[model samples]
Target: MTGTGALARMQAAFASAVTDGDEAAVTAHLAGDPALARRRLAIYREAIGANRRGALRSAFPVVARLVGEAFFDEAARRLAAVAPPACADLNRYGDGFPAFLSTYPHAEAMRWLADVARLEWAWHEALSAADATGIDFAALAAVPAEEQPALRFSLHPSVRLVRSAWPVLAIWEANQPGRDGTPDRDEGADDVLAWREDGRVRMALLAPPDAAFVEAIGRGTPLEVAAGSEGWDFAPMLVRLAAHGLLAGFAGPQSAG
Candidate 1:
């Protein structure tokens, strides 16, 4: 083999061995001693694997707390084995964790755990999202009534909605530090409205109608269409959204009046 081709092949083999735990492939490429090479590979694997699992633990501390450390660590290892980090940025590595937990055999009895993970991920994203200057509400109100229906509203960059059949918000709140009292297991379905305000991520439980309104707007629906969505009443929900400063801006035809 040419020098360049041999080097490329060795690099690929090394990567596959490191990530896939293929000791035999790596041992074949050892320079001096096979035992030394195995020891080095073992150390590398232990350190890198722990680092990756640590990132997941940090991102999903509540999950760790819920499932306990030993069990959570086992799940994290399994996740890393199947879905190794595709990006250099570890912060973005665990997006599939919630889905993984949902299908995990041990977690099937705790269906709500996955939703809680989703909420934590959303909150994490909101914390890192860009800031937005709120909309000019006075100008929005001043727009001609006839043109209002066509207006397209934009939510704040930090705004995120999490809809689940489980009472995720209540469960999350109950698990918070210093929180007392048991969470009601039968609290029913909930939709969470999350946003960053004053440099902190905050969340509120949305009513079904309000959840539909926000979901419609998030899909780029026109104001009139979102307002007229089934089970939605535009006025109070609009007031609540404005109060939360979620209306980042709007665009539409210029008012003739």
Candidate 2:
């Protein structure tokens, strides 16, 4: 094999040994006494597992706290075994964890756990998302009244909407540091909006209509259509979003005209 190919093969062998415990395939590449080489490889395997657990713990602290260290560690190990990290960046390693938790046999009783995990992941993503320039109010004011309804607004890149049948937001808030672990109520649905502002991740509980409106806006829906439902005024919501710097920009027929 060429040098590059040889290096790739070695790396693959090492990965299999450390991640899967299939040491026989990599035994030939060992550099010292056979037993000592095996021991060193064992240490590497343990270290890698610890790293995976640490990453998951960081991404899902609430989950860890809820399940306790033993349960969380075991779940983390199982997740790593089933779906190893696809990239070198450990920060992104737990993207699949919420889905994994949803179907996790041991977590079956805590049906709401998956939704909570989803919210936590959104917070993590919002924190990691790129910063965006706030809406240009001067330009927004310049749009003709007739064309305003057709405008499509952009949400900040960090904005995330999560709707769940469980009281996920309340549960999450209750679990925050220095708070009692009891949520105000535990049976109702929740609509959560997560975003980053001033280098901090912020979350809010949205009413159903407002959540729908924000979801529509995030999907690039036009203003008129997004607010088309009768008996609801989206003005306050709009003002609130603007105040929070959630509106990134806007474009529509006016821009083309």
Residue lDDT tens for model 1, 1-257: 69999899888778777777787766777888888887888788888888888889888877877888888989988999878888988888788899999999989988899999999888888888888888997888788889888888889898899999998888888777776525766577989998898889999998887898898887778888888746546789787888988889888756322
| TM-scores, each model vs. reference | 0.88, 0.95
- Inter-residue clash pairs, candidate 2: none
lDDT of each: 0.84, 0.93
RMSD for each of the candidates: 3.3, 1.7
By summed lDDT, the worst window of 10 consecutive residues in model 2 runs over: 248-257
Model 2 local distance difference test score? 0.93
Best by the TM-score measure? 2
lDDT by residue for model 2 (1-257), tens: 59999989989999999999999888998888999999999999999999999999999989998899999999999999899999899999999999999999999999999999999999999999999889999989998899989999999999999999999998998889998779988778999999999999999999999999999989888999999588999988889899999999999774643
Off by over 4 Å in 1: 1-8, 138-142, 229-232, 253-257
Stretches of candidate 2 exceeding 4 Å from the true structure: 254-257
